[model samples]
Target: MEEESMEEEGGGGCEAMMDDQNHNNWGAGGYGRHLLGPAAAPLGNSLLRGPAAGPTADPELSDVPEANGVLRGCEPGKGGAGAIAAAININASTSKFLMNVITIEDYKSTYWPKLDSAIDQLLTQSPGDYIPISYEQIYSCVYKCVCQQHSEQMYSDLIKKITNHLERVSKELQASPPDLYIERFNVALGQYMGALQSIVPLFIYMNKFYIETKLNRDLKDDLIKLFTEHVAEKHIYNLMPLLLEAQSTPFQITPSTMANIVKGLYTLRPEWVQMAPALFSKFIPNILPPAVESELQEYAAQDQKLQRELMQNGFDRGDQSRKRAGEELTYNGSSACASSRGYR
Candidate 1:
């Protein structure tokens, strides 16, 4: 009876040990399953294949290393580390790209002054003054300003510069002597247009993208209109009488000078010369005397005859110079020959 009781106790002990072993194996499999999803099945199967299998001697237990490697791959920081690193790198690159973008405020403070100075030089430069304008640098500034959506401000500033310059020109014209009036005014116009030839290209981006788009007007046309309003029209009453008096003086003012003034007026406002104020309409009939017209015609004929005589005189002078040059060359040659031939 004592031996049988001892055997029964041993059997119970064995059963409890098997249950504890199964429980430990289940816990490990459960941990892997929770973290690794379907991949943990092999771990569980290897550990819990049969009740009789020993903890360390099972054939399926050989696959535990591979399963552990897979678990390590799916581990929180270990498995997804490469992807996380890549994401971090992408975010850093994106931030760097955004930092390099040029903002409107930055462009205004840095690049705009270059353009303003260029315009100022153009407006204020004297005759024969050399303005050192860098086309590429100025163009880049304008391009950047336009790209940053600052084109409207650029256009407005340019218009203001031109208007102010023209106002100053008008004052100078008013102060000039009547005989020098047209000549001075024409010189001013020429300078203004010459400066614009340099300036217009720099502002072309603004003119095309902003001015034309928003205002539906051309830059050159606007400049001409401003000239008409601020200069030509403003000084018309002061300028017209002088122009007519100059036109009547045949020997004094050339026909080309009168034509240029008329053409300049027409260019400013097409109808102003002929129709708007009928510039010569009442002037010729009412203001100018008939005796002056007859005298002007006679003076014009005399002027043409004098010009022909002057041209003939110029030709005669040129012929005389050529003959003198030939004579000199012959004398020089003869002297050279005499010296070379041992003649005194």
Candidate 2:
């Protein structure tokens, strides 16, 4: 690569100094204390720890490494001893210090492509025929990246790429004609679930450990967010009229084989449920008979004793009248919040 070619960077900022701030003890420590001059350092951005950071990876370097795994910085012939520094500040005394510098370019062209392909295989290949031969290799590469102290950035990038892929899928799902929108979207969700089930095994470490412990999120939940936003929310919004129809198959399959898309939404956390209070409201009228609704509406406007009587006679509509009487209607999946709820 050309000089000043290091163009991107990744990794979190962590500063825990061990007495030796500027001390370069290369000889005393097994790995030489090699702090290159600022002019020639390429991977220096990641290694240098500063004050704080937000929820993203570090900024990109100006001269990132090339795809062939070639390290091009201050060459020995060009910058003399300074060139040999490349981009690392080695100072380890106890264990065998092996400074493996991985530039963002290498991650993009090398590691990410292989991982992306593996994911493609997982999501596309038939589950019966899916083979995760590269699970070990991929895990090891990620393990190396973590050991090299680049886990945060790698984790962040993985989240982004997965979200992007899910977005593409959601768009395709949305393109379905109105007549078949929910039906086709259900099929897509089934496909996505099958793909997730078939492939998640390969990345057990990433799902269980890296995602939860390091990233502070459950793997299953994080992935489900993609569908929740793209498929669930959109389907409810775009296909509300159809979904609310009494003959709508998606709503009719409630107690048994719920539409996979809706079931998928049910599997999400309470926050998602809270955000969609009105989502369940649309189907309320469809579920209950008009007579039952009228009886409940009467109780809703009457005394507590009469309301209790209506409730005991199986006409117990929780707040349905208030809901119908221009109240701040909501659906919180509770018998008390509203009997028509509990769709979960």
Candidate 3:
């Protein structure tokens, strides 16, 4: 009876030793399974069960306290399996976030057109005309575009739109009657700037972020530069003459109109106002009344005396007199004479 009891005790010790060895082997195989994927699963199972899974790999062995811990750890509710599921969920959430992010092209196509239309309406609409789009919608669209790295492209498009509009304004000025050119230009500039005043608030975010940060200039400065390039530069020569004419002779333009032009130029950029001295120096001679110098009576008499002698010498007196009278001899002769005189 004592031998029998000793043999049973030895068997139990061997079972415990086998369980411990299986647990250690299983722990090591867990890492291998992760590194090697499904191809290593059979190897890990053979190591966990010791060469072959048979009668010795008792299903009941999993009921042991240590085995229960390992089994429970692998269940969907806990341990590495749970961690894997959580990681998957986190990745899915991140993918969803990335999918929802707005792209620059999206803003350019969707929101930017709406903003451009509103700008056009503001620029071209008559005063007191109803504008269908609200300012808030424009602000939101601009905010979204700037937040999504669409600023530079949007700003470039804005410049093109404004420049095209100003080009049209310049053409109108070019076609205007010479006396009305300054007035038309001033009216166009006022309309453009006033429209910009209404439109600027909508792009405040872009002005603060993209324009200020990337270009080191504000939107207002960029707009002024566009005006300089497209409108002011193109018509500057003609504009300067008309402006000087207007300033000297207010009968050609209202005092208020001239004042507005001056104020608008000063407000747009101090550089523009500063250019006045240079423009005056360059253009004043063209616009100014021709200087009248009294000719010496003796020299004029000598010239007339020479002309009479030529005629007396039978140089066709009627033809000579007609030539001396300075009649326009060709269709463009009068225009050539006027051009030589000064701005008319």
Candidate 4:
């Protein structure tokens, strides 16, 4: 009996050792059924039969804890909540920024006429005050207003009037060389340049229009000549080199900048195109590269072929239309003659 008890104890020690070894190996290599073999089943069964097998009991109910202290002072009858709510309501109302809304109808009926009258008043002011106003200031204000208002017609008319005014004022300043007014004149010129910048797109649009319209050659020639004269007189030749250099650089010229140049050129009127080759050669040599020059010469030669084709097409269409009209007229005349012969 003593031997049997000792063997049973030895067997239990062996199983514990095996369980420990399996647990260590499982930790090292991760848990797997193959690692435990038959050891895990006995250990799991023994734990199931222990005190942990009993069902858990429900927790006892308890009362809520009292407050540490009461409010320092309390009103007997008046509600404090009403005053607190009123304070919140007042805060909410005061938090918003004030905004003014003007409807489109109100703008047209009330604001626009008033605005126009104000502008006219400023424009027609006495020469003393008007002359003192730099061309730059007038132009800047006009452009800003035009942009804000989205008034294309107003913008165009204002620009034309301002250009004419600047021209007239520039001449007047030149005639009556004011000692104190030199700075003012320079400022005015700067402002005029700003105005020109604003109207540049319009100039480009007009130039394309004229080109497409195929205005008379004589009128085109005259306009080119006028432009040339203006460029020479204005010392725009000096400015052109800088503009060319700017063009060659990586920085792109804005539409406004291009418009200014185009409009400036346009204002010089017709004579400028004739002088373009020489002017460009002197100022913007990069534009007339050797390859481009060669291409232009080639294009000139091809121009004759293009012109001939155009002329032939026009002649064919005109001749066919004229012949058809003539035949109709002749047939009508013969019919009248036959009627007269019958009457006789």
Candidate 5:
């Protein structure tokens, strides 16, 4: 009975050992099966296929040192590392191609053609007739071109050309028939005067030397006339007191010279009539014959009355039309004055 019990215990121990071994083997086999579903199958097949047999073995499975080196390099972790590296290389190549495409699109759409066309157009139009060109047209073109080209030197040259053309045209117009030339001359004169008023103050403040040296006396006189014609009489009255003060000095102002200056200012500042009633009254008597003064007053009254009637009647006319009419009459009157002076 003792021997049988010992044998029975030995048998139980052997059975337990076998059961543990079988369990471990079964777990390992289950793990291998899971891996083989997708991951291990391909590697297993490659190993079974073996590398290559001879020199003329499949090119797809050649056995050269390089090939063996590649296989060894691609083994397990190293082989998987090669596949990852290949994927990274392909992504990098694709990213570079996309960047190149974006750069090309930007160049074609915005920068390249615009620059080329502007350069070509500027070259073509550089030498055309600039004198007959209207100020509005020239200024518009110049502004457009400068903004596009961003060329300071080119802008300066264009401005200089326009100014020089204006000067030459003004000189020519002065010698032509006064009746025919007056309207065009006035237009050009108005443009130059506006520019002078706006630009000259800045130039004087910043670079007085340029004005004194470069802006000629003729241009100065022309600008003065333009401004004087538009000044109000209130300004003239204010100016008169100052002029009287200046004249009261030891070197007295002559009546004739004062009259001429006052006449020019009167054309500019009609509002001066309200300010210096006594002075204007005294001056008018001394300057003109009584009959002529009476006639002038009558004519002025008639003009005002007519203008009021036109406005009240709803005539669609502007100040410019009125100014042009006055200018035409002045031209005619000046011709008569010249004729009378010739007789004298």
Candidate 6:
């Protein structure tokens, strides 16, 4: 957690807002099995990953952000047995962790119009080809909001608007082709999360001090809630099977962690269970064991292929044997962009 030192200007600095799910060692929510357990997944039940940020009272004047931070997510291939289910994205977003002390009236009149336009670009633009907008400016705007005396309302409204936009994006995702839903989700989720992560730090000072402490919520939690509710769960319902297969790769995960995976599943979206009790009561338990077994067989086949390559290379050899295996077999894991903890 980054601490804020108060100054006259009261524009403040921020730290990276870490992900709710990343390198979680609770051993409670593995990538595969626990979804069959029950509702109320323990995942992210604790909102503050590390230390809470500075008090929400008032901020210092604006300066450059402290650093860049990654939005934690499962990359295509990363982690151990339970590592199969990757996070949203490991891409870094500038934590424009800052504050500006300006009145809400100024925020509404002077800054918001421009900020709103930048948000429009964020929503309308395509992946990697975003309309150029200064993230620094957005930080400046939100920072100013935090400095005002009546910032709680400001923050709430900001979250409401942001949520509305995300809901729009979610509705758009639903229009995509059924086969292309995951691909579309990957693209949309990446872009939206990146945008949200970048600007979130602007609200961090207030979130740490006032919002989380007083309102019992923070900017990170609200953004994640919007995604989990509006976007992630719908697609995850379809993608769960594939995620289980991916996590079970190499067969390194134990049943303990596999149970954690089930926990992770229950957390994805609980509303699904309420709407259709059978999804969990009927389908999950019956299917998951077989799924795990099937993934084990796949891992075994890969292991055998590795064994054959070793034999072909005169086993018990040096790096050359390993190189040969890399060339011959798909291998246990692929390259992943990951962060162990914190923003970097």
**lDDT by residue for model 2 over 85-182, one digit each (tens)?**
34333324212233234466666666667677777766655436746555667655664444334556666776677677778877886777776776
State the number of backbone clashes in model 3: 0
Reference-based TM-score, model 4? 0.22
Off by over 4 Å in 4: 1-160, 173-190, 196-273, 276-279, 286-344
Error of 5 at 235 (Å): 26
Per-residue lDDT of model 4, residues 1-344, tens digit only: 01111111212322232333453443213332223333233222322333222221111101111112111221222213332122222122122100111234443454344434444444345333433333343333333223223233443444454445555654554554333233333343444444344334333322222322333223233333432443224534544454555444323444345445544554554344344543334333343446554576676676566556557545332445434322332335777565555432
**Models, CA RMSD each:** 26.9, 16.0, 25.4, 35.0, 32.4, 25.8
Cα lDDT of all candidates, in order? 0.58, 0.49, 0.59, 0.36, 0.38, 0.48
lDDT of 5: 0.38
Q: Tens digit of lDDT per residue, candidate 3, span 229-342? A: 788778776776678766543245665777677666655555554456533333223333343556456556865776675566565445444343344443377776765564
lDDT tens digits by residue: candidate 5, 27-113: 213322232233333433344344433231223322212321222222232233234233222234333323322133343354334
Q: Candidates 1 and 3: which is better by TM-score? A: 1
lDDT per residue, candidate 6, 1-344, as tens digits? 22222232333322211122321332324321132122112212212122124321112201112222222332322322233213212222212222232445655666667667776676556656746776665665555445444456666666677778878877877787655554555566657666765566755656765678677877776777777877676666665554345344423333443444344345545555454343354335543334465578786886788677656656654455434222433333442212212223
Residue 68 displacement (Å), model 2: 31
TM-score of each: 0.53, 0.47, 0.52, 0.22, 0.20, 0.43
Lowest lDDT sum, 10 consecutive residues, model 2, at: 10-19
Model 1: residues with Cα > 4 Å off, grouped in runs: 1-104, 125-129, 254-256, 275-344
Runs with alpha carbons beyond 4 Å of true place in candidate 3:
1-100, 268-344
Deviation (Å) of 319 in candidate 3: 60
In model 2, which regions exceed 4 Å deviation? 1-103, 125-133, 198-214, 246-259, 269-344
